[model samples]
Target: MAAARDRGVRLGRPPAALPEGAPRAAELRAAGNSLAQIAAALNAEQVATPSGRGQWTKSSVQYVLTRYDQERADDG
Candidate 1:
């Protein structure tokens, strides 16, 4: 581990990156959109999901919102 660190190798899994639509999703939610509505809007806009596959679902939107919130909190 020390040798790898000295060689500039990163340890452990990479940090999670927010999806491209994450901020938009958070904004929509802040604008009082329901989870389903947010999902529909995202799908209509053809935004890529975190997985880069499949359409946005209410659950997925909620997950992204939660993660986005966590990231914001951490940053602040």
Candidate 2:
């Protein structure tokens, strides 16, 4: 485990599942949807959240989207 950590292995509860409409959410955001609006759109599409309960909220949507965007940025 220590050796894996030295190699940058992340040890935690596995990454949460991205909501089904994540790509669409990114598209909507690029087209200028507010975080709240993205959440609403996702909810309207019946996209399941990582937690699998409750309606989508701006914060949750932001977390997922921001993490995804950051990862993408890092890859480039």
Candidate 3:
């Protein structure tokens, strides 16, 4: 069990929200930061995942962007 834990097995929080800060992320995009760039920044900041991962899985980033678009559409 100890060995398994040492093997990068996470046994804590589910993981952090997938590259959150939707508004912040969108702002970065509008300011010319690419999606990859935003992800990198979030990772660099050590954003936690619900599963306790330290990075995003791409799809997560896309999810945030999609949500933001939907929100804007609804607001207008």
Candidate 4:
């Protein structure tokens, strides 16, 4: 873990809601959608992970959205 961190790699399962829903997640979050709402929206839209699973939990959405926010922060 320390070695990965030293290499700027985030250790853990990569977020499922990223790259695709990431932009939409930020938009929804900015528009005041709760984590549950965001998850529901993604599920309702039939979005799936790269593995083709459509299951989306609130925590998964939160993880993606939080990572998006952090990356945006780092960008500026």
Could you arrange the candidates by lDDT from highest to lowest?
1, 2, 4, 3
Model 3, 4-74: lDDT tens digits are 79998877776334344677667767888777887777677666533466575466556777777777897
Model 3, runs deviating above 4 Å: 1-20, 47-54
TM-score of 1: 0.79
Candidate 4 lDDT tens digits, 16-70 = 5445777887788889999899889888887763346757779878877778888
Per-model TM-score versus the true fold: 0.79, 0.72, 0.57, 0.69
Q: In lDDT terms, how accurate is model 2? A: 0.84
Off by over 4 Å in 2: 1-14
RMSD after CA superposition, every candidate: 4.4, 2.6, 11.1, 3.9
Candidate 3 lDDT at 72 equals 81
RMSD of 3: 11.1
- What lDDT score goes with residue 32 in model 3? 84
Local accuracy of candidate 2 as per-residue lDDT tens digits, 1-76 = 9999999999889766566667787998999999999899889988887588888899988888987787678889
Local distance difference test scores for all models: 0.95, 0.84, 0.67, 0.78
Whose TM-score is greatest here? 1
For each of the candidates, give the backbone clash count: 0, 0, 9, 0
Q: What are the clashing pairs of model 3? A: 14-50, 14-51, 15-49, 15-50, 15-51, 15-52, 16-48, 16-49, 16-50
Identify the runs in model 1 with alpha carbons over 4 angstroms from their true place: 1-15
Ranking by TM-score: 1, 2, 4, 3
